[model samples]
Target: MKLARFTEQGRTRIGKIEGDRIVDLSAITGDNHSMRRLLNHYRDWLPALQAATGPMFALSGVTLEAPIADPQKFLGIGMNYRQHAEEARQAGIPIPESQLWFNKQVSCITGPFAGVVKPAVSDKVDYEIELGVVIGQRCRHVKAADAADVIAGYLIVNDVSARDWLQKSPTFTLGKSFDTHGPIGPWLTTADEIADPQDLQMSLYVNGERRQHWRTSDMIHTLYQQIEYLSTVMTLEPGDILATGTPSGIGAPTGRFLQVGDVMRLEIDGLGFIENPVIADCAQEVMP
Candidate 1:
């Protein structure tokens, strides 16, 4: 089932996307729980909940929000694609053999179609298209072979970066965690729906120009390995998010960067597209 969150009458609710409408789970079960809460107990409630139904609202009319609200951990992998790593290397930056990971604080979460605020303090805003993995089950020290079992679903993610700030720190948090920078979710397509995570296609466009075009099959460390590698260091819990790295063709590689009013469109085969328009942030407005 496609799980999502939407706002109706100023209230947010977890829903199941049916066609172009959202079936309100709260109204069906009469419980005020978010998607994360429902996902925790999904095994018991899902079967019955799938059978029950309530008012279905037209999806076009309801405001779509990030499908998962406030994920426990929002992790991102950098340079996971060999080609992407090579691009960085060509830019005089060394690429790491192992996965280089970073955290995107939950505070940066934004809707798929939300406007991206280009911070005034930095002039190097950029866009990255990535596949987002949503954990369904908790697993620690998970084996690469068994990693797929712990996955719940997938979503399209745009990992917007402030290139100037990113280079200043070894860690990417400061550049990647800007508010409204992490635009994820049109909806989470359940694992069962996607036959193979590595078989999907990814495409990214900046202002209608195709920038990043690659296949997940090209990932240096596939999803399974990424999960296993991460689990070895920390517990992977339900509602945790992993943004598999982007492919080559980022602005940094081409000496191109985002400007105010730029539109970025990111899409994966099963996971729907997320389009965000760049806007000036609080600081940008004060420029002389």
Candidate 2:
């Protein structure tokens, strides 16, 4: 089942994405207001709801937004893709020996297809196409064998970065925490629907030119391994997200960089695509 969060009036609501329409999940499961709770207690309700198809709005009628709003934590892993890690090496950065983890301030999250504002202060904005893992339950020190069980589903993530700040600062916090940088969703596909996450094909296209293409099979650390490694350090709660690192072909590594009006479309098999227009913020507002 494809899940989404959309803006209706001035408020945000959760829904189930069906053929060209959205079934407001919040409308059916009265009093249960969030996708997180629905995933936890009413996991079985999806099929029944799918079959009970009622009035659904056309796909183009509503605006698409980030599927998971207000997740407890947004954890991101760097250099989890061998090819991407190699790209980091070519830039004179050492390949990490362990899963390199960091926090994306939740506020950076943006709707799918939303415009990504290239910060005015940094002219070196870059993009990273990654597979996002959404956890279903409270996971503490889970083993690799138990990892998949804790997963709710997957989504596409663009881990937008600011190269200059990242290279000059002691940490990556400022470079990665720009508002509207993290473009997620299009849809959040449930785990059971995806037979094997490891074998799926993924790619990114910039202005219709294929830039990065690879399979999840090439990942240096598999999704389950990422789960086990991160869970040992912190509890993976319902709605907690982990973005397994991007593949190669990012701009900075090749001496090419984004300019105003560039469009990036990233997609993974089973999970849908997210397309965003890049706009320059020449005013240089300090990141919030």
- Which candidate number maximizes TM-score? 1
lDDT of 2 by residue, 80-198 (tens): 78888888898889998888888888898998989999887888988888889999888799999989999999999999988897877656877888888889998778898899998
lDDT of 1 by residue, 109-221 (tens): 99988999988888898888899999998789999999999998999989889999888877889988988989999988889999989989999998899999999998988
- Give the Cα error of residue 207 in candidate 1, in Å: 2.1
Backbone clash total for model 2 is: 0
Regions of candidate 1 where Cα sits further than 4 Å from its true position: 28-33, 284-288
For all predicted structures, in order, the TM-scores are 0.95, 0.92
Report lDDT (Cα) of residue 240, candidate 2: 85
Inter-residue clash pairs, candidate 1: 120-284
Q: Candidate 2, residue 266: CA error in Å?
A: 0.8
The number of the candidate with the highest lDDT is 1
The TM-score of predicted model 2 comes to 0.92
